[model samples]
Target: MLHPEIQAKARAELEGVIGLDDNGHIPRLPDFEDRPKTPYLEYILLETTRWAPLSPLGVPHASTNADEYKGYYIPAGATVFANAYAMSRDERYYSSPEEFNPDRYIPVSEGGRGEPHPEGPFGFGRRVCPGQHLAMAGVWICIATLLATMELKCPVDEEGKELRPTVGFSDGLSGVPDAFGCRMVVREEAMELLGL
Candidate 1:
């Protein structure tokens, strides 16, 4: 909902992939099988993780031995934390870092202005979350299904002015959107497809 254009593009991809029935209803639900074929959806999921990582400060790591790098010294057994959030928005890696633009992850040859982002959302190295693959898969499926089935929009007030909630997050070990209002109306085709 924060980005209507991205949502529309995703919806178009879903319609192209899953297609519609003779009655103009979606023929079937998106599944894991469709993941590889939906590159845009993949970018959406990746951008989501990069835009707001669940663990801003990745799981801390302790150096097993003393080390020196870039003229900096590290003591043995020193606790170190990887700031994944900072890296995600680094200007060197991303243009318009503040904007949640999925096109940044798309290939330049495909009309997108940027290239695929380097991996970092899930911590680096062997210590990275073991469930990273499963997590991404789940997210992809959920996003794809949602885009294919519903229309997400920010709620409006009685005066018809759009009531966009302040984009804020909670303070804690994890970061998630603060309370906000959005309307998830099932698409007409989707409702019919679900026989509702």
Candidate 2:
């Protein structure tokens, strides 16, 4: 809701793939195989994770062998927590770390920066989240369906002004955002497809 431009761009990408009928009716919602045609969808997913990581402090990891590199003392066994939030916002890697821009994830060959995805969000090495792939697939499908069927907008007041929700997050292992109101209006094409 906060980023209509991004949504519109993604919608355009979808239309280019799925297309519309002569009466401008939606043919059908997108499927998993259409993922490649709409690369922006992946970018949006990546941007969401990069902007606000689910787990700010990644799962605690134990150091098998400790050593001093930055002049710190060495320890045999140590508990280390990677700061994913900090890593995502590193200015050296991100052009404007604070901005929620999805284009950063595009590959360099495609004229994008080819920036690396935030690794700490999932985890490192053999300890990575097992359901990461499934989670991405499910979320992508849900998002694509919604984008195809409806237009997401912020809830508005009677005064004709947008009621921007206070962006607050629950602090914990997973920093889930607090409730925010949005208005999802069914698209004209989708309504027509449903024989409305």
Best prediction by lDDT: 2
For every candidate structure, what is the RMSD over all alpha carbons to the true structure, in angstroms?
Answer: 1.3, 1.8
Q: At residue 99, what lDDT does model 1 achieve?
A: 85
Please give the CA lDDT of all the candidate structures: 0.84, 0.88
The C-alpha TM-scores of every prediction are 0.95, 0.91
User: Highest TM-score: which candidate?
Assistant: 1
lDDT of 2 by residue, 43-124 (tens): 9999888889899988877778977858976576787878899999998998898898998988999999988877777877
**Model 2 steric clash pairs:** none
Q: What range of 10 consecutive residues in model 1 has the weakest lDDT sum? A: 111-120
Displacement of residue 121 (Cα, Å) in model 1 is: 1.5
What TM-score does structure 1 among the candidates reach? 0.95
